[model samples]
Target: MIADGLNSKVFLAPMAGITDKPMRKLVHSFGAGNIVSEMVAINALSRRNAKTYRIADVRDEPYPVTVQLVGSEPKLFAESAKLVAELGAYSIDINMGCPVKKIVANKSGAYLMTEPKLAADIIKAVKQSIKLPVSVKFRKGWDHKSVNAVEFAKICQDSGADYLTIHGRTKSDMYSGNADWDIIAAVKQAVRIPVVGNGDIDSVYKAKEMIEYTKVDGVMIGRAALGRPWLIAQTHNYLENGLEPEETSITLIKQTMLEHISQLQKYYGEKMALALSRKYVCWYCKNLRNARKFREIYVKINNTEQAIAEIERFFAENGSDIDERS
Candidate 1:
């Protein structure tokens, strides 16, 4: 059962450089309630880069889509929100959780969490600029020493955020250890607007616990969905029927990879698709028999045709069963 509310509970996180339109469509087709596009730099949107315009486009999806913008400047942030709304975004999501060095150095992303006041200002500017619903996604805080999700949630709400998504780990933790659901619960308690719990929800059991324990309005899964976008649909089914997800077969996994590659080729040209698919290619091959050998072969190929051929040959000749537990 999809969580009923102003916003559906299951959202796809805005993974920069990865979750393009093709991948976003695939995740949605698999049953994600809400999805965010890849993070776009606010500064880039303001300048109206042709490449950014292509990335910001969201005309294909039928469901409500939120475009995430990252930046610390108030005026530019406001302008960017207006532009995105004009581009037909259902909502605007401000990213304060990205831990990339480039974003932090620019006083954006997770670094904004260090100053709740400034974070609030950016939200305020965006809300004031656009009529669409505005939200914020952020880490626990800048680091463990400064962990304060509750305070940040309040700041965002007071400034005009319609909802909040809290990634359980602190900025300092990066992608290590476990994401603390305790703090996410605290944020829920501190704010009246819906709270979306994120981080470390890699399984159906964890998804149920995060919602039931943290009392969050929704949940967002990140890295866990790398080669397994179907996890979102599996989670939705688990919530609805209590049925375990069927284990993904080696054949189906290979087919999915091929389809994903084909979609990338359609959206981006052959060269760009080949380049972007490398990381995904590596991810899909993980833990399989002869994966090392496949990686050795796949990484060396430069053309899409060769890469596809290598993938088909490896799976047909040496693929092993994947343990698709949920």
Candidate 2:
């Protein structure tokens, strides 16, 4: 129950390479109302660069879109916020949790945690420069020993951030081990603004537990929904009405895969779409029977026609069979 009365609390994390417009639309079709765009470079967006503009584009995007931007400079951060507002973003999320080596090496993302003053400066600048709601995503800290998420949460709130997202692991953890929900609970305790808990929430049960335990206003999913965008609707339905989404069948899976491919084809072109779908194709088959054999063939798909053929062939061979893998 996000206070914004958005359709669902399950949010699509702003992945750097994965959450493109096509993918965002795919998730939206499956009942995600609060899809976040892929993270754009604040500096690039500040300059109104074409490539950055495309990523920040909300035209034809589903309602209440949250655009995420990354940068270390306060002025550029403020400019990017205004750019997103003009582009029709419902809210702006500052990227402080990205742990990629390049982003950290550049003194952006999680590295911002090491300098609370700069993090506050960026948030304050964006909050002051734009009329849109501003949010920040941050980690527990740079690492375990230096966990200062609570203090940072206070800084974000003090700087006028309307909401905060805490990915419970430190940058050093880097998607390793479990996300420390205890830290999330602590941060929620420290801040009055909505705290979104992100980490290790791979199931509705976990999602429910996090909401109940941490008392966070929302939950963000990253890798868990790769081929399961329906999980967003499912989470919403369960959280709101205490009902589970019917299990996705193989036939529905095939149909959804084709629909996703078609969207990708339209947005990214057939060749690039086919190549980009390789990972998602693998994710779709990861939990099915004969998945090992199916993945071996699916990963080798090189063209849209071949991809279509493989999709039909795999369902013909493994239809109605389900198991567990990733």
Worst 10 residues of 2 by lDDT: 1-10
User: For model 1, how does the per-residue alpha-carbon lDDT over 257-289 read when each residue is reduced to its tens digit?
Assistant: 888899999999898888888888788877777
How does residue 322 of candidate 2 score in lDDT?
74
Q: Please provide, for model 2 over 1-326, each residue's C-alpha lDDT reduced to its tens digit, 9 standing for 90 to 100.
A: 45453557778888877888877888887774467888999877777788889889896774788989898999889888887888878889999989999888877999999999999999999988988878899999999799999999999999998888999999999989989999999999998888889998787788899999999988988888888877777787788789876867787778888888888899878888888888877777767888788778877877778879978988887785676443
Candidate with the greatest TM-score versus the true structure: 2
**C-alpha displacement of 215 in model 1, angstroms?**
1.2
* RMSD (CA, angstroms), candidate 2: 1.6
Best by lDDT: 2
Error of 1 at 324 (Å): 6.1
Which residue pairs overlap in candidate 1's backbone?
Answer: none
lDDT of all predictions, in order shown? Answer: 0.83, 0.85
> What local lDDT does model 1 show for residue 221?
81
